[model samples]
Target chain A: MKVLVTVKEVAEVDDEFQISGLDVDDGSLEYDLNEWDDYAVEEAVQLSEADDDVEVVTVTIGPERAEETIRMALAKGADRAVRVWDDNLADAGFLDVDTKAALLAAVAEAEAPDIVFSGVQAGDDANGATGVALAERLGFEWAAVVNDFELDRDADVASVRRELEGGVEELTDVELPAVFTIQTGINEPRYASLRGIRQAQRKELEVRTIDDVGLDESVLESPVDRTDMYEPASEGDATYWEGSPEETAGELAAFLRDEGVVSS
Target chain B: MSVLAVAEHRRGEVRDVSYELVTAGRRLADGLGGELNLLVVGGDVDGFAEDLNRDGVDTVYTVDDGEEFNHGIHAAAIERLHADLEPTALVAPNSVDGLDYAPAVAQRLDVPLVTDVIDFEVDGGGIEVTREQYGGKVETTYQVDADQYAVTVRPAEWPQAEDRGDAAVEPIDVDVGGESGTTVNGFEEVGGGDVDITEADVLVSIGRGIEEAENLPLVEELADTLGATLSSSRPIVDNEWLPKNRQVGQSGKVVTPDVYIAIGISGAVQHVAGMKGADTIVAINTDPNAPIYDIADYGIVDDLFDVVPALIEEFGGDPPEV
Candidate 1:
């Protein structure tokens, strides 16, 4: 069986940052593997480790700079990697859900993996829609916010637990040829060891353009356009305690005592 | 140019987002000069439809299906409803199940989808959605230039519709029984442990700012000094530094303590959802722009490492050496 994991390298903005046109200034941004996708990669890799004939392949839609993030996934245990990017995409200011699902659908059609894994949402956009949209495009089954699962190879079913709000988990069983959007805290994602990191350098990392993935510039067309980006005007009316640590702490202590929730 | 809003339910009760979708749908419908139609797919459809008929709703459509949410059934039912109604826009909750089916429905209909929209406006037959990015540090607006679109509104952003309306309750038969790719077995309530943080009057919560598992003692000492229960944001529980029972967020326990002292917590939307009801909220963090400040009644903008020790000293307690 083959598993395809969708990985993304998302940008984390600094506490104090500047906005440059449509996005955060490059100088104030830090790039890393998405926290949620890390869990998805580990889920796929663990599946590969538990079974005899399971093969893990990761697919990413990012620029060449994302190779570092892709390599991190490879080091964690993915057998190989496929990256889809080109100039047309780099110029596309905002890629909406349809555009992204179409791009991923093109790759999924070519690879045709038995199972697909993606993060519940990206840390940046947080759309939380691409995987289910991709599944719909491929006519495959899907489950979202899946935190735990037991895959039955023989029956070709995955008994999964979808984490809901307020500490409730819905149990469900999805048929094979399905997509599972893995949630965080599902499993402990292991760190890439020294040997794994060295081995990742030699792993096959294939780069393909939009056309190479059997698509053209038309895939970049979307109805959604990002108009503006800015730090939201602060709605805070908080009474700030401004002083040295001792003075501010004293203020908080006095307030807590006045409220009778704390005693000194 | 009507708006269709779908309601969600679990077990036997309709979720709060269902009512919130009504508020969003009514706003868009008013802007577009059309009607606002509501939908309840499964699990007590009649009852849910009655509850969802808010002041501005014109029609409530109910499709009686299973007792629980199965994405396969939900996706099929919603797609069929959209095709029949042909509304100018479709609105759903950005809940876990909403993420499951809204995207699939939008994909099948080939409409532009914008998820987790905190605010939106309809103008000249087009829509612009406002959403947060970089973990709510910044907000971005996007214009969707389409005749029809789908959007999921973030939960708790809009107030729940409480006033009942005089809308026509209609039962619509949607054929979703043949949809069998997935089956929802049942639901399980997790996070049962030694401590029930919900019962506490005071909660000292830590977040990613705590830095490492070894540094947890710093916050433990503060909680002890205040004689408060210990809780945390999702990351601390995700990191396994604390047990799942101690987690305070959307997926964790909803805590309404008398005093919620948030140390080093950035107050992500999920984290805020769990603790925003506290009577008094105090934040201690170095970042002045953290979302936690928006809801905080009192705040100290300083490194937690410095302020925590001082707070312990003010309470006449020795800070633990981490």
Candidate 2:
């Protein structure tokens, strides 16, 4: 079984973001593989480790810096890497969703992977729309927020567990050649081993362009309006509740009741 | 030509967020110079749809089937409806179920999809949607360049319209026959003893500032006395002081109530993003400069220990002693 996983380079989750005076490209910030995409790569690697015939390939779209992200995935145990590099992609603004979807669709058509994996949502834009769109373009069945999965190559079916508001739903016997968007907490992602890092340095990575994949720039959707982007305003003064446990509890209860939070 | 809104229901009750989506859809439809039609899908959900017949909705399309909610089935039903009705726009609630099906429906129809839209308006030949990004530290606006667009309205962001009217209910015979790519084998409801925070009119959320897990009894006592549902930031849930079901943040639940009281919370962007939509926000952090205060309507610069008891005394409410 072959698996194709999509990874994205995004602003680091922990970095403090600052608006660069209305200039999108002028913004200087540290970057890393999107937090959720790490889970996608992790799931793909685990599937490969479980099956001898399974091969995991990672794909991303960005400038040359994005290669580092692909390298990180390769180190984590992807069999190979693909970078869809384009200089126009930097100022590309909002078109990444459609562009990436088109790229993934093209790749899937060429390789015909048995399964495709993506993060439930990207950490940077957090759109959570691309995976389903890509799946639809490729005409594959998809399950979103999937936490558990079991593949039956013989039966051509996959059983998956999806997370809901309060519980888990066990999805039984879904057809394969499908896409699954992995939610966080689905599995604990393993650290890249030293041996894996060395092997990643020697692995083959293929770079493809829009023209090479028979994709047109006309399909890209541009942002209609550029709204003012700003940091969210802060709120409140910190109030500390203190005293003996009994005293604090008594006081807190009274406060809630008085504030009309509780029925008095 | 008008917009179509999907109302979500379970067990004969309409979810609160469904009303919010209708309110937003009504506004968008009006802005587009079109009427709004509400669509409800579920078994025996006509009662739920009837209750949502407010001013903005021109008609209600009810598709009631005994089948449990399945993503593939729902998508197919919606695809058929979209082709038949030819709505200019489609709106869904950004709940777990809505997120599961909305994108698929949009994809099946080859339309653009936007999820978690906090604010939206109809632009020239497109829809502009503003959503929180980077864990709510920054807000980004997106415009879908498609003739027909679909969006999921974030819960609690828009006010639920209360225009009372008995809308004409149109029963649509949908062929619920489809190969379900997935089946629900079982379900386990979390926090059965506690009230759902999403339905709470008032919420008091705690953070790491609570100091210790043993001290949660203080917050719990307050919640008990006030009849307020207790919620917390992700860290508190991570620390096991509260159940994961009670965590309120970007990664957890987004809540909007009449009043939201932040007790001892430092207000990380993730936590603030969830409650910033409350009508009246009150912050009770010991640090006067905590981020939670920026959006708070009332700020207490003193220690919660000093202020909370004073507030109780002022209101003449007695606390329950353990």
- Per-candidate iRMS values, in order, are 0.9, 6.9
TM score of chain A per candidate: 0.98, 0.83
lDDT digits (tens) for residues A78-143 of candidate 2: 999877765555555555454567778887788788899999888767778778778878878788
Q: What is the lDDT of residue A51 in candidate 1?
A: 92
Evaluated with DockQ, which candidate comes out highest? 1
Candidate 1: regions farther than 4 A off? B177-179
Report the TM-score of candidate 1, chain B only.
0.97
Question: Candidate 2 chain B — worst ten consecutive residues by lDDT sum?
Answer: B313-322
Q: How do the residues A1-264 of candidate 1 rate in per-residue lDDT, one tens digit apiece?
A: 999999999999888899999999999999999999999999999999999799999999999999999999999999999999988888886788888888889888999999999999999989999999999999999999999979999999999999999999999999989999999989999999899999999999998999999988988888899999999998888999999999999999999999998766
Q: What does fnat come to for each candidate?
A: 0.94, 0.41
Name the lDDT of candidate 2.
0.73
Model 1 residue A263 distance off true place after TM-score fit, in angstroms: 2.0
* Model 1 chain B worst lDDT run, 10 consecutive residues: B172-181
lDDT of 1: 0.92
Mark the regions of model 2 whose C-alpha exceeds 4 Å error after superposition. Answer: A13-17, A21-27, A166-173, A223-227, A232-264, B144-146, B176-178, B190-322
